[model samples]
Target: MTQREKAKQPIEADVVVVGGGPAGINAAIAAGRLGARTVLIERYGFVGGMSTAALVYPWMTFHTVEGKQVIGGIADELVRRLQAIGASPGHVRDTVGFVNTITPYHPEVYKTLAVDMLHEAGVKLIAHSFVDSVAMEGDRIAAVRLTSKSGRLEVRGKVFVDTSGDADLAYLSGAPTLQGRDEDGRTQPMTMKFRMRGVDLAKVKQYMLDNPDEFYRKTPIDELESLPLSGVMGFFKQWNAAQLPINRDQVLFFTGPEPDEVLVNTTRVQGLDGTDVEDLTEAEHLGRKQAQQVADFMIRELPGFERASLSQVGAQIGIRETRRIVGRYTLEAADVVEGRRFDDVIARSGYPIDIHDPSGKGVAASWVKGDGAYDIPYRCLLPQRVNNLLVGGRCISTSHEALATTRLTPSCMATGQAAGAAAALAAEQGLAPGELDVRLLQEALRAEGALLV
Candidate 1:
């Protein structure tokens, strides 16, 4: 390779998506299915970002307040296909609540399914590649420089979608972003999810119904000190204000094909900045150590976990909060509480305003009752000054309060699909994403099986 050849070579595509998780995968697939040459770049080798790589099983809130399926398109198809292959467990139709309408999948199985979906859609996948910087031409993004084992390279696109969850590309492109809340600007805590094997599922359930207190008292985990997992069990009651009642026998375990396995979602690593590489690196090490300790405590202290062993740890530490792009409109907490609707609403979310304490040990979630659900305006996904850039996933424009509700995977997928579709239309019409016709974009989204109301 000569000196001229060593210069960052540019690879062009119609749409270039950053991040290969649910949001990125759906975005790339949607764009490709729409006849756009899409290139998806991921830091890891897998396709499903959080769901697969982070081992975050069981996507939350895929339905509406009226018990109707709200998240459709590629999101619905991905779940259905995984279920057919025994990768995901079948959902209990209209179960106890809206959150229960969707099913949880095995993380490993989900990874396989996501890769298959991308392949079928003809999306060019470049895994193990990290997007380092954005190349701008005037007001629009011209290309993005990525670094991998093969060295530095550039991927140029007409329209760019920031699905990195951290909003790396968007921020590097000089887009204004809000991290966490305004008062102190503290990001939510990070978690390291792990799975345990040899759990006695029946005993776990019995313990929750029988001796909830005894379970909390015996478990050494800090989150179970007062408010524990048991508090989240009541059918209609909200566990937001009160402390979660601890599940002595791990009653909240996900029931997958492996009877002995139990997924643990409890490692709360706090005070670490997701944007800081040093902080993130420390958080990962600390999270893994804590996960092992929790696993050991399960076997030693908990009744049903006497023989339980650590099965697997999450590939990436689960980052709860990060950058919130300052878009044309920012969804506020008041909007969420009032269930505000917008004329240009692209999707709706009913999940509670769950603000995980910066302490990372416990959550400060507030539930909305009655018909309390908010519409996510299309503007929140579009940056104010940027012309061709769109943001999806956890980094969308929202107030500190509203970001919590919109951070979930299902909602992220919804925003990602819409953003991708909008980007494709903008490129095909030779217009900026912000200048694209809203009504036409909405119609296209609906036609592509997206649930937009």
Candidate 2:
């Protein structure tokens, strides 16, 4: 059939979630379980998004530095499911001193389990579909256009939840959005994660002990020896000596469920806009080239990687920052650092402000004050100018500095859970997301085991 001749196939749902990443996955699940007819569209064949596609490993910390679990509900449930199947070792100590705990799992296993959960929740999955445009009725998104195997289709929904980490849905709907840092529109660097197997971790630990000053400053030898599986982020002397082209002052790798495997998150492609196709293409090329360089350096220099082989490279480069919607209320940097509470809080995160340098090497991070948790207000999910739409993930309303903390995997999942529940509630009540009662949303989230104070 001719492209123009083909009819726009229509699918109807109460909540239509775009992007099947960690945020979208939880959003669809929460909405579906809340009795909303949920539809989740993914660009790829699988649903794990960054977790499976980009190989962003060891879901960085669901807890505060004090070991208080700030994220629960669907996020925790996913981990428990993985544990039940022996596909994950669950949360382990962060010997790198970056976070309280890092949850590591097998990427393929994560893909399978995520799909299973979505099906169990009765969320209709549309894989290999890319959202091309949006049909709007005044300020509300009437439907989203999708190009999939069945040909061009239109999905109509009462409420739309954008979990497209890049804010593709909100941006396409003509909503005013913020991109990158405020000063120059430059985003945090993109990383291409790679994995290596056949590593001798014992020798690696011995080297860290012998050269105590070579690793992360906060991590002590005692904590390093406490866990058999720990995230490692040092070997500065070797990294400096090798003079690798890859950016960053130190090398970072994390142990996984596999004894001999380590996920390498070292390659950085700075000064690239993840939203731009050309930039994404260039980033993909540069990131892969840099990944090869890092793997070679590890094998030749690191004590544990003498026999390690580059087993896998990420299907896509890991994007840290992108387009953020200008919602009803923007989360400020101080709110994150001071652990500010909100009267309409829907989600909470203890993960620190971790900014991967936009145009330079290294990262700048600041921890949250008090118990190390801060509120993600419900208003952050309600993008201005859009009546029936809610957003989750890194794209939610936040300043550039605050985005640094909310961009983590666990934080994204938390906001996603909020967005999904809010979408369901709004659809049921026949009201705009802004008109929906924040208290009702909070009650729903709490019943699902979400931690919101």
Among the numbered candidates, top TM-score falls to 2
TM-score of each: 0.88, 0.98
Q: Name the best candidate (by lDDT).
A: 2
Candidate 2 Cα deviation (angstroms), residue 312: 0.5
Q: For residues 1-453, write the lDDT of model 2, one tens digit per residue.
A: 665555365789999999999999999999999999999999999988888899988898889998999999899999999999999888877888778788988889889899899999999999999999999999999999998887788999999999999999999999989998879989899999999999999999988878889988876577566667477888988999998887788998988658898999999999888999999999999999999999999999889899999999999999999999999999999999999999999999999999889888879999999989999999999999989999999899999999999999999999999999999999999999999899999999999999986
Write one digit per residue (lDDT tens) for candidate 1, span 241-324. 222322111223344447667677666777779999999999999889877766765576666778788988988899989987
lDDT of 1 at 424: 82
Residue-level error in angstroms, candidate 1, position 7: 8.8
- TM-score of candidate 2 versus the correct structure, residues matched by position: 0.98
C-alpha local distance difference test of each model: 0.76, 0.91
RMSD of 2: 1.6
